[model samples]
Target: MKILQSKYTNSFFVLLTVTGLLSSCYKPKKHFLQASGNYVLALRTQGTNSTTDYLLSMDTINTASKNISATGNGIEQLAWCYFGSTGSTVFSFSYGTNNVGIGYGVREGGGLYEKGRFSFERMDCFGKGDDNTLVAIGAPWGGGSYDCQIQLIDATTMSIKKKKLTPLYMRDGSDKLNKWPTSIVVNDNKMYVSFYPLDGGSWNTDLTDTAYVTIYSYPAMDSLTTIKDTRTGPIGYYGNQVNMIKSENGDIYTLSPSSLAAGYTQVTRKSGILRIKNGQQSFDPSYFFDVETASGGAKVLSATYAGNGLLVARLQIPGSDDISKLWAAFDVTIPICKIAIIDLNNKTVTDVTDIPVHGGQYGAQGLVEDGKVYLSVTSTIAGEARIYAIDPLTATATKAAKIEGLEVPAIYKIVN
Candidate 1:
């Protein structure tokens, strides 16, 4: 589609800090982890006007003696971005100001470098397509349009491969409103993009009693069908969190966080999980996991699939969802977020008691290695920013690496 190129290609924002080492060193996260790869962390700290992000490639993250700081240590992104990875490339989709996506890669053995970048119209949410494609959906705002611009990026060359202006299909077969996309999941040769009907002008989610996912053929990018399930409010929430995940057996599971904590004015249906069996285009009628009830009425904040029918989730503290404090769900000081393990198969929520309660998490993509997912845990009580290695099955967590900044929103292990 000939995506536009950024004019400021090699611009690097210099970051400085005067504080000394803020943490003590420990040991590697896992001894059995492979030694031939590098770990990349996108560290986000505050700037004058917006947040500043830096991609730091390091060897170890668990030791208190080792404090990793974004200061003069990594690739500084243009601005705050929504991140997602496919294959070896990590994409930083610029949000708020710039409409460009820049990709970073691991050096021969250690360090980070920019692979390429391309500008686009707008990409509100992101998904991984196969091993070489990064999919983005540019949804309209404020009752302006019904067309969602879908674009695919070739990770190899870091260019927009193709784009299509696909229109939304409402229940009445009339496009009077716009559907905002939450996430995209491509599996089994089909692309699944989940959305919720929204009145842009009113900014209220009127159709919040059903889940919607549109299926399209892969590579060919053909819209095959639109599927809806009334068991949940919608297949996703706001702030670009991943709402769907594909398991090992190729079954796609979608999470509907119909919670007011995530900016939903009214949550009609219960927050839940729905699945699409392998090689199928429709939701599995027999499966529906009531996550809201499982979490004891607390609103789900974020979730990342951790294989084997388990998901590492963050839930708000019961009775802490105060919409009056705008975006309080993510305001780390609120002390309302709890880390738990969700079993999709048995429909259970196991609370991990080792970690302290915090505000909320910003990253949607969790870094999983050696059967444990690495999460950036920041607790006001703990008094430090650290990476907690959580075992989904056991529902336990161990403080691994210490981060000197705010939080490591995105992490990736690049085996170059």
Candidate 2:
């Protein structure tokens, strides 16, 4: 009887402990996903189609420690989104699956706060209208309609201030094609958008001979003139990238990557760079940088303005000779690109030797701090994702903090 009583008592205690532990887990407690720091970086894991991304904030990203994993860290995003920053705020704009844009701000008290979120029908490309506004362009991926949507989000209110549905430039009635926007740049009182013409149904870029840029009056959505340059095939690719950058003096420089790997159906023209002198509506007549010839036929995938009329660009290695792989460029799992510093003034390409060959990323904004350019790369050769600081003048690279993920989608500094 004593043994039976002891066994019952022991079982009852075990049950009580289990219930207490479970209750503690279910206790009402506030769960906050705030990180401590002044800088934010988007660490993306897995592939792009169905991706899992995390926005982690840290005090510094230059520590040469072991790989910094994004697992079990920071705020998990609502959906797959690309980043667009204005001032001290970072926005996660919806990609393919969802239609929402979430904003996060670096708090003065050392943690991040969910600033706000906005929704729209679609937002494919982004442009910084100013310090307070973000311009988003929404083009259809596949549909019977050709109408595009544009929205301007005010950072102060975290809501879209204005929206318009109109075509940047109307296509000829006889041409059954669609203009797909790759990048948007707002300079002064004008807005410039780069696009490629493709068959809406088949996605065939048949007009592979000239690059196009449409101009619109700033803050006013109206049909403006479309500028065409025949030196390159097109200005950009499928996903919005930093293809066009405005220099300090207001000159708008555009990168045209007529490479099959960059979603071009065929490469009939040389990849190059063109400029629209500040406040002008046409490409400069005498300035043309043939990037394909300069880099021995390698096509540039993305170019970020590094300062002093220099662009830190990522060019495809062996430059996409294979036209068979339709979506080869977006498949970043394969390492097929390398970083190079391009002199916009001298038309020279210098390769960064220290950084290993890496893959392509959509909308890669190389963060410039002081004189060095910091870019996120997934070095499949090194078997890790990390940040590399490259000196534009010397064409050298140095490794920084390691990333424990597929890629660091963006590196940002937001001071409170």
Candidate 3:
């Protein structure tokens, strides 16, 4: 770790003196502290929204710094294909065409087709496929439920294949797909598919809303032999980013966020931790986590078991609100992000620290590989989302690197 500078020391000392003299002291936080790392910080000029794709070469960090090997240029999404214990390789996919517009002005939320919004186009799977794999899923805006088809792409060619997979509900036993697919995850040799309903149309009004998880055996994205019950938890909680982890003793846990009602005051949304333990196919009915918020509820952005009944989670504070609400109550302070150290053995959740939100709207989206937490700060003021390396053990942040030119930084994981 780098030592605090003498100039900072003097400046802080003066501030501390003023704080002590004032009726209410304002203390400075160590938000911009520097720490040392052996890894390279690479920049790419040809990515999804930004101009670059980045693949960190941990094995070759000693030889190159800021040197990223590009997978697919001029694209928004990328994923590493991990062939289940056979090792891993890079496979990236960019929609051949632009379809949706920005969510707001020139089309708001950005273009759907241009930004990989049609399905899990925002998500990439990292698994070996025997010539057939569900590479992307989602609905192209202004399309029907059938518009939500799953693209079985050719891993080698990085091209969308002719064969596509759709849920039983979406198809007529023929090869039709749905329009409201949400998220996808692979577990225990079975593929879990979650689907939702589309909004703003005639069929959208007739849409009988439901979510499904279709499980299929490996090597075949075909034939949904078993339908897993995903309704064990609360209703109306849209699930995303399902992950599976196994303990050394052989117990399995599935972790994801279960979003609840919105905040009464702020634009914050509430979510709680959802855990399915002991190889169970469904969520435990009584296993709701305790996350209290008037506006934004408890949300688990990223979670991983740390063994011996401990789990580390990257949590975001409630700041996501409607623009009108923000304008009405304009003096709202930005909530500081935090990391919760959950001890399942003791059944307790401990607040680690105020993880530091520099500027406005910055939140943590990724996990740190070396037990540290990685946070992505979307500073409209900075015009980029800066990634920070948080030492969970010390509750200190080390300014790591920045991801520039993104509308917002989504989930990312450390590969090294």
Which candidate should be chosen as best, given TM-score against the real structure? 2
Candidate 3 segments exceeding 4 Å error = 1-87, 96-135, 138-141, 151-162, 168-179, 200-212, 222-270, 290-296, 301-316, 319-354, 358-368, 380-384, 391-396, 402-416
- Candidate order by TM-score, decreasing, is 2, 1, 3
lDDT of 1 by residue, 280-368 (tens): 98999999888878778866666878888898987776766544533455455557778899888888988999889876655536788
Q: RMSDs, each prediction?
A: 8.6, 12.4, 15.5
In model 2, what are the clashing residue pairs, if there are any? none
Q: Candidate 3, residues 46-144: lDDT per residue as tens digits?
A: 233222222232222212122222232122222211111001123322222222211100112221111122223432223224423434553443444
lDDT of 2 by residue, 1-416 (tens): 11112122232222223212212222122324555667688876664323456787776776668455555457766556678888777898754334668888887855567889877777888888888898988886564667678889898889999988866666687766778888888887888999888877666788989888999888996757899989877898876688898999999988888777676777789889999999999999899999888888777888778899888889887645565544455555567788999999999998887989877766667788888888888777878778888889899988888887767778888875
Report backbone clashes per prediction. 11, 0, 37
Candidate 1: Cα lDDT at 233: 83
lDDT of 1 at 157: 85
Off by over 4 Å in 2: 1-33, 47-50, 95-98
TM-score of each prediction: 0.87, 0.89, 0.52
Between candidates 2 and 3, name the one with more favorable TM-score: 2
